[model samples]
Target chain A: MPPPAKIRIDLNSAVPAYRQIVDAVRVLLVEGALPPGSELPSVRRLAMDLGVHFNTVGEAYRELAAEGWLDLRHGRGATVIARGSPAARPEQLQEFRTRLRSLVAQMRSEGVAPARIAAELRSLTESLKP
Target chain B: MNSALFLSLLVVAFTGAFMLLVPHFSSPRYLFAVTVPAGFRASEPGRAAIRRYHWWVVRAIAASAVIVATMAQSWPDLAVVLAMLPAIAGVASFLRERSKLQGYAAPPPGVREADLAPDGDHLPRWIALALVPLALPLAAAAYLRAHWSEIPERFPVHWGAAGEPNRWAGKTPAAVYGPLLSGAGMMLFLLLLGLAIFYGSRRAPQRTAILKILVACVYFLGFIFTGVGLMPVVRVPIAAFLVATFLFAAAVIAWGYKIVTDPAQPVEATLDQYWYLGSIYCNPQDPAIFVQKRIGFGYTINFGNRMSWLLLGSFLAGMLGLVRVAR
Candidate 1:
């Protein structure tokens, strides 16, 4: 078996610390870094190791929970739920499309060409490949 | 009690309370954790993103360790303080991410822009809260300035360092010039930072030019004071002046940057991009955590370096004085 999934963060990124955590956890779930049913380090343990606030780690885990990538129990820490496909409720799917469209529009307003945006999406998909 | 002293005491007490609250609130989350398996089975782009973030985080921690170690030998006290640096940064990131994830309510189909902007703004309150910490520090500094002589040249006897006491020689040439120039540099630094922030908040196009000028003024005056002390006739004072200059430069740069960018933006992060970037000194793109967005900036990193360096310079001067006394 591959080594246990270790989540790390970059202090210098333009992303917010909590967002970075969410993104990192998301990537782990999508890439099979942590398979479905895999257990994650306690938010506190991860926070301590990463030298971040426990809240920051907790927030990341919460994000994953919302996305259905991880299951958080009251006293059990976080466990992997769905690995590759985040279970999407019908309402959630609709919301996702709306958010995605607005996000794209925001990019376009900022002068990003459609081709470039497409490339970014393509890159994101490619990165998810197992 | 003096208001500043009272405030300072209050801050210490609050910080202590915060520390205690940590484990109580975080224990459950720490005890049980979960993660989805990576797609090594079909390894997709999503997997790479997570892997990348992991790598980046590792690198950031490693670099922080090296910096702390290298600077420690020269400034042991500062080094110890630096130890807490990574922990603060890491935790901040963790909490932020967790909150975002928790707040995630998948957008409903055709969700409008109006929905994205939550009603009854939460951001303003948070910003106000952030400003609260600054108040205590500023109040204390202001009080000290108003009662400069009462501020005590040395800290209380109980808190004194382990080494031999280094008292300022009465009526020394260096002592006269050292404080004067250092004080001036401090004032200039504050002015520049204030200007940067003030200008940045406005919509005027000329604000950028004003910021550039303010920044330049800080750098220029800082060196000027140091250079004045370096003159053959003023060598003794030069050392102290340089220490002050370093501090002034760091503070201005840190606060100045905050005036320009709001860390609240959505984008990739670099350590320098966030308003808080000064909190952690090194770059955040290390390989331990990869595929992360741009890093946010924090004042702790950049300002910490300046504060540490200032103390170091002061210590060096004290040592030199002791050597002269022996001679």
Candidate 2:
């Protein structure tokens, strides 16, 4: 596993605030900076840390949650859920299955073959498991 | 009921409908057409500045809703009500920001326009795409309607203040509507979710049918039972079901519009590629890059769509129940 990513906010960059947040979180997840089961800073705290509003952080968290990266509870704040984690119940599994199918379709359209895609997916799944 | 009651009901229903609709109608382009656009061509720096300002406005509006919700003496429904303004602002900001990013550089020398356009006869395909998700919800609705007698009857009612400070506040009697109306609302919600899924599947078409079916089944389970098995735990599933449905619906609408209006570019093309020098979707990417660019974030229209339906369902059920009780 990698170290947690250093969260950076580029005030001068042209990227939108939400995208910046998304990018930063993505970097952390990709880099293993935020390990599976790591608790993320509260949206309020992160917003204050980044000098952005709570909604910016919330939106970022919401996006992440939608993508299966973060687990969002009403007041518990966001927590990193490793990709392909086993935390999903039946319904959540269905959601993941749906997302995976979409990703597969997308990758296929990109000409990724089944064998190569399957291998890469297996590796990804291994990385996500506890 | 008296004319006054009828009028109040009509106003409330319309208010709910308008609240549900504001996002769809006052979308970014529509709002920008009313406000900015012409101002964008002045300078690149000016455009960037406008984009930043748009984000700030979105934040401010969302914050205002949070404040109002804090002060309001309504039910938990106020949060859903408050959420509408910011959600709309967020969408508007997305469009405005995309517009600001127009025309930094020209396209590559020999990029064929034909490669950009996916194919002809896309309308029927698109409509089919939209309808795919509808099947699950319709099935769920039909099942619930047929088994309406199996639905449990218990108010599980509580009278208290509900909102930011209190869970239930300023409450009247548990305004009961009949099981039939509640069932009907579930069906309506399923219908909306189907529409949303159909729209969403256009952008991401993996297991579109199965996902809809799964979502519908989960929701159907929540709607049919009388909170019997879970007791206090029931609300959690119910809330999740509603939230998921709403987010799913919104995703469908947003993505569906993208599919119908624009030439079907491959997924990887950024908004900058498709645009006509900074109009709505000018940016372009090839099919390969587009398909490969899944960073795990696509809009889920489930949250708002479900809430709107839940409230509508709850209200209808309550009204019908009130009539039955009165009769």
- What C-alpha lDDT, on a 0 to 100 scale, does residue B313 get in candidate 2? 69
Candidate 1 chain A, poorest ten consecutive residues by summed lDDT: A44-53
Per-residue alpha-carbon lDDT of model 1 for B28-70, expressed as tens digits?
A: 1110011112222123532343344344444545555566556
Quote the positional error of residue B59 for candidate 1 in Å: 41
What C-alpha lDDT, on a 0 to 100 scale, does residue B163 get in candidate 1?
Answer: 28
* DockQ scores of all models, one per candidate: 0.02, 0.01
- Model 2 residue A19 CA deviation (Å) reads 42
Angstrom error at residue B301, model 1: 17
Angstrom error of the Cα, residue A9, model 1: value is 4.9
